[model samples]
Target chain A: MILDLHNHSIKSDDGRARVESYCQWIRKKEIPIDGFVLTEHRQYDDESDYRALEDEFGLRILKGSEVETEYGHVLVFGVNDDLRAAFDFTRIDLPLATVLEESGRCGAQAVPCHPGRPNVGLCAHYETRGVPEGVEIIEVASGGSRAGEDEAAAALAERHDYAGVGGSDAHIVSHIGRCATRFPREIRDEEDLVAALREGGFEAVRWT
Target chain B: MMVEFGDEFEFQPDVSMPTVKSFTTEATRMDFWRFTDHEKARELGGLPGAIVPGIMSQGILAAAIHRFLPGSTIRKIDTIFRAPLLVDSSPTARGVVTHVDEEEGTAEIDLTLVNEAGETPVLGTAVVEVARAE
Candidate 1:
């Protein structure tokens, strides 16, 4: 199954379209995908309305968030109420290890989003603190960043042997699916995606 | 000329808590985006100390543009985050006019948010309407 593991909805400060808007566009364009993850920036609150749209489109809808940690923006998938209680995500100064530890406790997979996107990226910061453990994947490609940056990140991921992923990082309707990940198995929910992330059965691909 | 290519208008933004508190996001209060605490900001960006938000710097630049070309509309702002603007030392936002079209009545401006140490934290370009004749 194909999933654009990253993108933002109207829930994000810079994003324009709502979660449903993304689902509608996918249906209209007949994009070959089973689902996509909505990774809102610095926030985590998924409404039930999104699930209904998931049913309507016959596609799985997963919840994720692009958290602005002290180091950089980190993409966290499989968030749960228990995990939220353990960590304060609203603050932008969360330490990198804290986030990963919490995600681990909640069975979530935390990947640094766009590790090469300038100041907000974790790639340079990694030079200071180095890559932490439990980080099995990294976003080597992002539609929202520079092309050279994405290529450089892809090379870094290759060198580190970290499973690479890609996303459109879309803040609007037109910005969807410039990059995506193809999973080897079908995913019906967030649990499956999390498992897929850990087991390593995905490949990052770019269309635009 | 008053409006030469390298001509610039500069101002120091008020970083006081009360003043910054008055500035809110387009959507919600979002105070965390504005509040300045050196230790926290340093922890956030791994910088030297307390630094202002890049968005807030952009906001100050937008305000400067509106003040310069009164009653004019700002069309676009292309900002590239260069460094973190330290908060303890006063930071200045400058708008340098690059090109002006007499007939079009539009101005192309380059902006820099620089700290007291002359470090430019944010560099951006703006397209704005200079003015129109009656």
Candidate 2:
């Protein structure tokens, strides 16, 4: 099965598109992908509703949060209440290291979003000491405005021998499913997605 | 006080950050900004003085914006921290309106986090969506 591992819904403060709108567009376009991970900015309070929508539409859905850290946006998967309680993303003051350490504590997977994008990307690691430990995944390709940065991110992932994933980073319906990760195993739930990502059970793929 | 297009707002408020917990994330602590400031802590990765992480200043800037325009969504913020903000002393954050787009209903606000003696440490530019009075 295919999963658009990164995208946002109206739940994200920056997002104005509805999740159902993306679903309808996916159906009409007959997109090869099966579902997407709705990564709202620093919020994941709509998991159950998305799961219900999944059951109704016969498409799988997962939940994640794109956190604005001191450096850039970090995509966090498998977060729980404890993780949410750890940092305030709106503050934009959440240190990257703090989020990684807390992700470890919450048993969540922490991946840097768009490592090559400027300002809000990992390319500016010179400001800090270096890449922090515990980061295992990087978004090599995104459906956002900075597709050019993908090569650098892919290069970073290859050099570090880490897994590279693709996410649309879509705040709108049109960008949905433009980038995704082809998984070796079917991801029926959030746990499976996290496990597949960590075990290298997927490959990043993008359309154009 | 009706805020005009070029009013500079100054606030010398107490700033508190998320208490740095154990390198271990566990329970027990109500302190604002790291319950424990341990020296030689491995989690800190070794640094001089109990300096606040640069990220917290961004939150302080957000708070400043929120106070000025309640219910306004802070769309994006850009901050550059020139020096380490010491955790023990009081630092002030100031904001000024740089531009106003009446058609788009947005305003560009700039912020500066300063030391007690008045040194600009963190500089920020934020775009806030607001409904300005016509």
Candidate 3:
């Protein structure tokens, strides 16, 4: 199963695409993916109901978040009450360890994304502080990354032997499904997504 | 002309309903219902009236900057729209130069558009290339 693991809708401060627009684009383009994840920046709107759109589009739309940390931005899946109570997602200076370890403890996965970009990516932080302790998954292919950024991120993942995933990191509708992750098994929900990341049966893929 | 740090400027553009509708309509091509139809906007959990599109708010900031720095080129402008600016509201676009690189002939400016209620609906940073000395 293939899924665009990172996306942002109008809820994100910088995101321009609407939720329905993304689905419409994906169907129109006939992108060969089962679904895409809505990884909004800073905060997750758990109250957002996409059931009707999902039914109409025949796509799985899961909710996740892209949050800032001292080590840069991390994509978090399977956010729950415990995770929300522990870390305020709005704080840009979240501790890397807490984000990674606490996410794991709360049955979630926090993967550092765009690891090649300057300030926000993990490559710069790794140069200063090596790899943080619970970082097992790295986003190697990001659609929003500039020319050489994705290559650098892939190299970092290779150096650390971390399982890599791909995401569109799409803030706009036209860019959705540009990159994705291919999982060995189907991901029915956020729980399955977390399990897939931890199980190591997924690989980064780019859509042609 | 060398752009200096802490150089500030302000502009109060026309944020009236017709102006907002014209800008919003032209920008979105009338495809975004929330910006064109008040009833659709309200039904979709948006403002009671059409709101100024965020891109238009950015455009307002860009226009303000152009007025302040006449011959300068805006290399990049990254903005975050914090709140919605209603069509009928009045807003003041203000800019402050935060950094200046003489060798590169560039300056970084922080920009904001504050509504009548003193709430900043649009805030951003812009990198502009100052016109060199003749």
Candidate 4:
């Protein structure tokens, strides 16, 4: 199953696209992908229901969150009540160590996103603190990255021997499937996605 | 204050260095690195330079509308931030009258602020109360 693992909707402060608009654009553009995860910045809304849109569009819509930490912006998938309670996702400078460990304990995956970008990327943080513990996955191919940024992220992932995933990191409708992760097996829900990441048989692909 | 349907006007506000700098300071709590840091902005998203706040762009539109209509009062202004407007870059605010209610002295104008890069960083529609012509 191929999924655009990172995306943002109007819920994000900077995101401009509506959830239905993203689905409509994907279908109109003929983006051949299974679905996408709406990784809204700073907060995850468990109450957000997209079952109707998913059914109508034949896409699996999932919810995740992109949060800022001392290490940079991390994309947390399979977020549960425990992870939410353990860390306040609204804080811009959450402790990276605790985030990673707590995410693991909660059976969630916290992957550093756009690891090549400055200020909020892991590469810049690595210069000062090296690698944080339990960072198994990093977003290597980001649709929003400009020029050599993704290459830098790929290099970091390779150097650290970490698994890589791809996401569009789209804030608008047209950018939805520029990059995606292709999983070897079908992923039905957030649990399956976490399990797939743990099982390790996927590759990040540039869709556009 | 008689704005006919299909009438068009353009305005380019001085989004000067001081203006962008001051706006950044005013928006301290909602700070994003891309708005004030040049090198970081380019490094992060390959932006041409530090971007002006989107709200600043919207404010520019409001100012332009007031300038064009003079006695017009903005009843409602809805804006959509399409892209980042780079600091010091010239963006022309264009307004096209779409609907004019003669009895009510109201005009609905389609608005667009196109930057030097030819990108419409802001787009929206505004409803303004035009003064009755003597």
Candidate 5:
């Protein structure tokens, strides 16, 4: 199964493409991916749209939010919709550890997004502290720029022996499927996807 | 002709200020960008859940300086982040004209970002090269 673990839709404050637009592009390009996860920013506001597109496209659609934490951004997957509502999108008081614990309690795996991008939100401490449990993967691809940060992140994942995932982190139609992770195992649900990531059975690929 | 260093020109704070809304609304919204994470921003001692992109603040500072130093271009600005500008927080760019060198065609400005609580989030100095009107 192939998965684009990191991506953003128009629901994100800075995204420029809608879910439907990406769906069409995916079909047009005949991309070989079994699932796509919509990791919107600040908050998760496109569950219905994601579900609709998933059903129409026969793709496994996962809903997740890139929760902004004080230490950095963590991708929270498998959280209940109700729990999402209670999330304080504007609060920056919680520590990175607390945020990770909350994400797990909410039935989501807290995966750190990009960890190296200059003055961007990279949890350098976490990287040095060693990979925490319940944190499944490291994002290796973001946008189209294949800068040294991604390479360094890839190296970090290898050194730590954690699951390394890649996604376009696409905010526009042109960026979907630009980078993705292909898993050898079949993923029937979100849990399966997480398991695949944790076991390191996926390969990161970039499509032209 | 040259005059005494301190007597040749005067320095004053630019009265015009740039609002937070003007910067956030007008400038490009940073998303999934590494340096602008809402969470990591906090860890870095930012008050908001996210870090206001330094560039955004820099742009606003540029605008504030533009008001007083007309026809001047920012040569370089060095800023130190004392505090993080949180999301949705209203911060204003305040500048004080510190030094003006007419012979060198330059002006030195001290810039700061003041939030609602009257705290300075960032403090820095910027040198502007002004093109005197012909």
Candidate 6:
């Protein structure tokens, strides 16, 4: 199963494209992406919209949020409504380690998003200091704008002994499937997908 | 008052025109990253010398907006990277106020970050909240 595990939609502050628009672009490009995770930033408003797209497009869609942690940005996948409701998006006082621990306990994978960006958020220091136990993937691609950063991220993943994952980190429709990761096993659900990633059953691939 | 759509802005380089060699030298001197080598900058998708940070480009856009539409606080910015900006490149940041909602006290500006080579390194729009002057 190929999955673009990190991405954004109109739900994010920086995103300007709809979920359906991105799905359509994937189909048009003939990219062999089997699933996509809508990891919108700090907002869970797009869950219904993403579900609708999944039903219409027949693709495995995962719902998650990329929260801005004190150390940097972290992806919290597999977060159910109850858990999301309990968490506060504006709280940035928690240490990186505490955030990772909570995310792990919640059964959500705490993958850091775009650690190489110069100054916006997370960097190598946090990644090295507070990496969670099931932290399996490092984002190696984003919207074709930061190929150099992607390469650096890939190197970091290799250095840290983590699996490499790529995503467009796209906020616009044209960028959805620009990058993805192909898994070695068939993932039937969110649990299986997370397991596949944890077991190192994936390879990063770019669409174009 | 807002600057109407289609307004133009320009920023001239310290020197008249730039050659590839000068561009490379200027890009190498930028302190955004620890490395100062042209090849390293190139490897980082920066033009073959000292490339400006994308945030710097955004800063230039912020300056342009402040110049035309004073008292505007940048609420959101979305930028798309198109090409590498060579060092010493004479790039101009331009913007136009596209939409305004009177009740929300917000305006949207279409912005572009372009260089002398006629290449657009980053293009996107920003949403700003304009505060009325006291």
Candidate DockQ values, in order, are 0.03, 0.02, 0.04, 0.07, 0.02, 0.06
Candidate 4 Cα RMSD after full superposition onto the native fold (Å): 8.5
The candidate scoring highest on DockQ is 4
Residues B1-134 of candidate 4 have per-residue lDDT tens digits of 48765577898877766677777677544467677777888999688788888778888888889888988899998787756777778889888665667878898776778777544667776889997766
The residue ranges of model 3 lying beyond 4 angstroms of the native Cα positions read B1-134
In candidate 4, what are the lDDT values of residues A1-208, reduced to their tens digit? Answer: 9999999987988775678868876776689899999999999978779999999999999998999999899999999999999989999999889889999999999999999887888988997987788899999999877556789999998988999999998865656799999999999999889999999979999964
Give the winner by TM-score. 4
- Model 6 lDDT, residue A72, Cα: 66
* Candidate 5 ranges beyond 4 A from true positions: A46-49, A81-93, A121-136, A144-146, B1-134
Say which prediction, candidate 1 or candidate 2, comes out ahead on DockQ.
Answer: 1
The candidate, 1 or 6, that scores higher on DockQ is 6
- List the candidate numbers ranked by lDDT, top first: 4, 3, 1, 2, 6, 5
Total clashing pairs for each candidate: 1, 6, 0, 0, 15, 5
lDDT of 3: 0.83
- Docking quality tier of model 4: incorrect
My TM-score estimates for the predictions, one after another, are 0.61, 0.59, 0.63, 0.67, 0.55, 0.61
Over the true interface, candidate 2 deviates by an RMSD, in Å, of 16.1
Q: Estimate, for each residue in A160-186, the C-alpha lDDT of model 2 and write its tens digit.
A: 887888888876455578889998888
Clashing pairs in 6: A72-A122, B27-B49, B27-B50, B28-B49, B28-B50
Across A22-126, the per-residue lDDT of candidate 3 in tens digits comes to: 887788768988899999999988989998998999999999999999899999999999999889999999999999989989999999999988789999898
Q: Name the weakest run of 10 consecutive residues (lDDT summed) in model 4 chain B.
A: B24-33
After superposition, the stretches of candidate 1 with alpha carbons farther than 4 Å from their true spots are B1-134
Once superposed on the true structure, which residue ranges of model 2 sit more than 4 Å away at CA? A46-48, A145-147, B1-134
Off by over 4 Å in 6: A92-94, A121-135, A144-147, B1-121, B125-134
Task: Report model 2's TM-score to 2 decimal places.
Answer: 0.59
Give candidate 4 regions above 4 Å deviation.
B1-134
Q: Per-residue lDDT of A1-208 in model 6, one digit per residue for the tens?
A: 8888888876777776666656666665566888788887776554364566777877887877788766567776666655565577556554556556676676666677776764433554555556444455666655443435666676778777777677777665545677787888877666776677667867878765
**Best of the two (2, 6) by lDDT:** 2
Candidate 2 local lDDT, B13-122, one digit each (tens): 55433333421124333332232353542246353345555556687788898888876778888776655666556888788765566777776676777776544557
